[model samples]
Target: MTDSDRERWDARFTGLGPGEPGPPGALVGREHLVPASGRALDLACGRGTVAVWLARRGLEVDAVDVSPVGLAAGRAQAPEVHWIRADLDDGLPVTGPYDVIVCQRFRDPALHPALIGALAPGGLLVISVLSQAGDAGGPFRAPPGELLAAFGGLAVLHHAEGHGEESLVARG
Candidate 1:
């Protein structure tokens, strides 16, 4: 991401305030799949909602984002989480064999393979993205079946596409 991209995100997050930590969108009804004790990585973690949630569940959490302002808010909410400041465009900064990985509201096809490779045995992956499946198509939205096409090799736990969103939960 460029400096302007970071600044744009920082500005947006600054207005949103410190967001409440919550379960990942894809894990809403499948929360039991989350490992009780293991390491987790939250990509494009924004205000660290999922990262903080994982930490509270006894996992060591790493949350990455480009916005310093966003990280600060999350840091205040859960100081235990390792809040990383980096652009995802440069690829993942932290090597991983994480027991759980989450990417919510962010879609980057280039990162999908890396995400799969980073999972530990039987690790869980929870991801959600805006989609064109049940809405007007757009450049920023994933095409139909995008999640399954990208992650079908995994042991799919759940998958849904509708209401302009797509989500997948799988075990590696």
Candidate 2:
């Protein structure tokens, strides 16, 4: 992403402020599936809410984002989390064999393979993204069946698409 893109995200987070800790969007009702203790990675982890939640659940957590302001807000909430600031446009910076990986509201088909490769055996992948399915299509929205097309090989535990969002929870 460009420096202006980073600045825009920083400004947006500055306006939104720190977020409350919560389960990853796709894991909201199925929180039981998350391992009680394991390594976790939150990609494009804006404000680090889900990352902090994972840490609180007794998991080692790494939260990555492009905005320093957002990372700072999350770091304040949980100093234990390893907060990484890097433009995802540079590509996935952290290698992994993570037990749980989450990417919410961030769509990059280019990283799908890297994400799947990062998971440890029996690891869970939680992802949510804006989608055109059941809504007026837009440039940023994924086409219908996008997540399934990209991740169908995994053992999908949950999948939902509608109302401008697509979410999936699958085991690697």
The best candidate in terms of TM-score = 2
Number of clashes recorded per candidate: 0, 0
Q: What TM value does model 1 have?
A: 0.96
lDDT per residue for candidate 1 within 39-142, as digits (tens), equals: 99999999888888899999999999999999998999999899999899888788889999999988899999999999998999999999998899887899
Give the runs in model 1 whose Cα sits over 4 Å from its true position.
Answer: none
lDDT of predicted model 2: 0.93
- Per-residue lDDT of 1-67 in model 2, one digit per residue for the tens? 8889899988899967679999977888899999999899999998999999999999999999999
**What lDDT does candidate 2 reach at residue 119?**
94
What range of 10 consecutive residues in model 1 has the weakest lDDT sum? 12-21
